[model samples]
Target: MARWSNWSGRQRSKPVAVQFVRSESDAAAIVRTANSAGRTVRVAGAGHSHSPLVVTDGVIIDTSGLAGVISTDAQQRRAWMWAGTRIHALGRALHDAGLGLVNQGDIDRQAIGGAIATGTHGTGASLRNLSAAVVGARIVLASGDVIECDRNRYPELLEVARLNLGSIGIVTRLQLELRDAYRLREQAWQAAFEDIAPQLESLARATRHFEFFWYPQTDMAHAKAIDETNAEPVYPLAAEGERCAYSYEVLPNDRPHLHTEMEYSVPAAHGLSCLDAIRTLIRRDFPDVRWPVEYRTLAADDVWLSTAYQRDTVTISVHQDIAEDETPYFRACEEIFLNYDGRPHWGKVNYLERETLAKIHPRWQDWWQARERIDPRGTFLNDYLRRIRPR
Candidate 1:
């Protein structure tokens, strides 16, 4: 068994033992061994999480070796990929097969299982979290029993398991819903903070996806609009503006000033007003501030626990330099965020505890109940999971 820890190095918890289960039988055997010994077990993937969900003093199953895509059903609009599959590799495979993920997060290094477990997502008014795209999954329960989960089988568990946070069991296989691959046309521009607010709603409606970034302490902002369109003929650029759509030289690789970020998803109807108020509060009240304020949008979906469950949303992601303590800044932002009925992303840093988060997520209690059923002993649980969904 290989050992691992999360990205931030904030909290470290090691397992009592570790094992690499290459197959279903191997996973089953490992579970049986743990059950017999009366020990808890958890699955560890990319470990990109900032939270301590993967931390455990018990048995840990490393799924890195369980790699490969099992099958694809074009007619069914689905493909079965192994749990260890990383987003970058999976995207390439899907693209080669003329299918692509419905959407993807900014970072592509996370494995499928972990992403689904934590509900990783990207921004777009028409997109939902990655977990929402899961049609089925093969999970290994604590009892060493394996089962297929979907709307038809284990219907109740299926809903919660999509974003199970690894509480239910180790997800070994995933059946994803994909669409025909398409190219995205992206446009970038700068705008004033006040000016952006009025056009936000219109811009989001006009584009397939829209994102904005504001430099804190300054009124300057940058916005990007991406739209899906017919494949354009591959042509050489006239030797001026970097020559091509996918050319790396055309993209800026420069890193921006680092900052402590706190992002929140607010209902789309409050998009302009919320952004406006936040900008005003930060600029007028906190003049010494200097960080980027970013925003993105996504369409509503059926994922019960998704931030965009039944409402189109605008995500306001604010960044503050690492040198600055974010307490006061985030405190100010939280007032506006909460006033707009915002839901913070699970993976990002935030201060809201479980009780308050529960109100924003109406299904929090139900999902917590289902999580308890699968991990009654808190085998796969961690401090963050406990905080958000305490048993």
Candidate 2:
């Protein structure tokens, strides 16, 4: 047996075998062999997801070997990369080809496929989640068949594959709709919570990207904003301050694997009140806990299972240093989020079940139908994902 644990040292799994694949055919063969023996198969990327999405007792396929920029189309503003390519690597690779991602989250360690599966996003009023950026994918189905999907080819499948949560298939290559190469100027500032809370929406609207970090014991927060610029790059990028560099270089922060996180997206209108409620809960009960809360925004997207599906949203994340118990704090925060109609991030620490999950996503059944079309035999499903469906 092979042992695997996620980035946070949580969500461990002991699979019967672990195989690394360098090509689409290899992944398909592994899935086919496992299915023949009635064993479920799960693909593991950088293993950065905090959820148990990758936990399985069956065979584990490591896709890191199938990584790199494959091609670029400057005129169409699109690019294709192997599924296992890391976001940071893609950022640099894409920039060299006169293209860049529409947006990127602060952390860049996740595999492109994993990040898309989890509906990850950067902070911006106009930007949508990474799932929304996906224009096409080459997937290996449970039956050992390959499928290519895009807006014109199997368009309905493309919509489901956008945010399939790894239930659809093993994505070998991803086609991203991008932009002509660009640079960004990143600036950091501090502000009191009250002042910043009320202005989050306005700030998000005013900037290309905006987000903040708030600690439980403090009334103030560390805030940041990034916007495109034609100015010269800044040198000596400190731990924090200012920098002007390629969009990829400036967009991703150097995030150490310090804390495990819990994130949820609520309606944009409810962002401030939810923050206020969390602050009150933390102060009145968890005063000793000092991890920062992250606040960001996502434009509405149509990806069925996306946390921000069909509605503009505010994504708020709470974290605790990995050394401590994050349950009580995370669970309490979840309660408040649910009260405000928040949807949990698929890759983060969340206690949501199918009942609650189904209620929030209007296209719940449609997403399942898409999954059924891809893997009706449940060959790609792990016990964790099985819970995503109603009994």
Candidate 3:
């Protein structure tokens, strides 16, 4: 058996077989073969997701072989790329074509398909998650059928494919709506948590991108703000640390350290109170929790499975060092988030089951219906999907 593990080394699996596919046809063939053998099939991208979305005992389709830019339309500001293209590579490719992703998360190591599938996002009150920018995609179904979907084509299916949790089908290629290449100005500073907590709402409304990392054990918080600017790039002194660069270059940060993370989205109105409660709990009980808790805001989207579905959200992410036991901490935080009507990030760690998830997401059943239409046999369903999305 071939062993596989996630980026954070929290989830591991030993697949019966791992096949590296180079094209859509290759992926289709693998799916057909697996179906014929009565075995399940799952596709693995960069394996950045903390959840066991890709863990499988059957055949594993590795998509890295089907990578790179396929086509670009300058007039329409759209680009087509293979699903396996990494976010960083996509950024550079689009930049060369005078285009850029509308928004991106801090970590750029995830494959484009995986990122969109999991509803990955960045910090921006006005900007939507990466899934919203997906205008079209080519998905290979369980029976080896290739379906092309977009707004003009299978509009309904396009919605399902946008934020698919690998339960619908394997996305072979994607066509994304891009923005004209732009520059951004970023400023970062450290401040006390109490001082910034009260002003977070106004700051989020005013800035294009505003997020912060608050240390649970201390009163310190690292705040960052970014905004689109027409000014030329500048190099500032150490004291006046401001960076001006291309949108992609300035958005992603280098994360050399690894940790297990759990993130949930709450109603924008109750976000601050939730954060305050979490801070109080951590300080009073889990004194050993030292990792910073990240906070960011996101605009709502129509994607069915999106955490910010149909409502603006404030996302809170709690992390623990790789060496620490995250069970107690994550469970406690989950309880707090659930009190505020939180929706967990699909790709991150969480203990929510189907019954609970259905209660929180208004379109949960709708998403499952779409999943059944494309993958009736559940060929794409792995153990993780089966546990959370039972038949």
Which runs in model 3 stand beyond 4 Å of their true positions?
A: 234-241
| Per-candidate TM-score against the hidden true structure | 0.86, 0.97, 0.97
Question: By the TM-score metric, which is better: model 1 or model 2?
Answer: 2
Tens-digit per-residue lDDT, 256-362, candidate 3: 78898999999999999999989988998898888999999999999888999999999999998888899999999999999999999988999988899989989
Best by lDDT: 3
Superior candidate under TM-score, 1 versus 3: 3
Which scores greater on lDDT, model 1 or model 2? 2
Candidate 1: where are CA atoms >4 Å away? 1-3, 17-19, 35-38, 233-260, 284-289, 320-324
lDDT digits (tens) for residues 30-120 of candidate 1: 8888878877776777776655667777787888888877888766668999988877677657766777777776566678888888777
Rate residue 256 of model 3 by lDDT. Answer: 70
lDDT of 2 by residue, 188-218 (tens): 9998887787777778899999989987777
* Global lDDT scores for all candidate models: 0.74, 0.89, 0.89
Best by TM-score: 2
Ranking by lDDT: 3, 2, 1
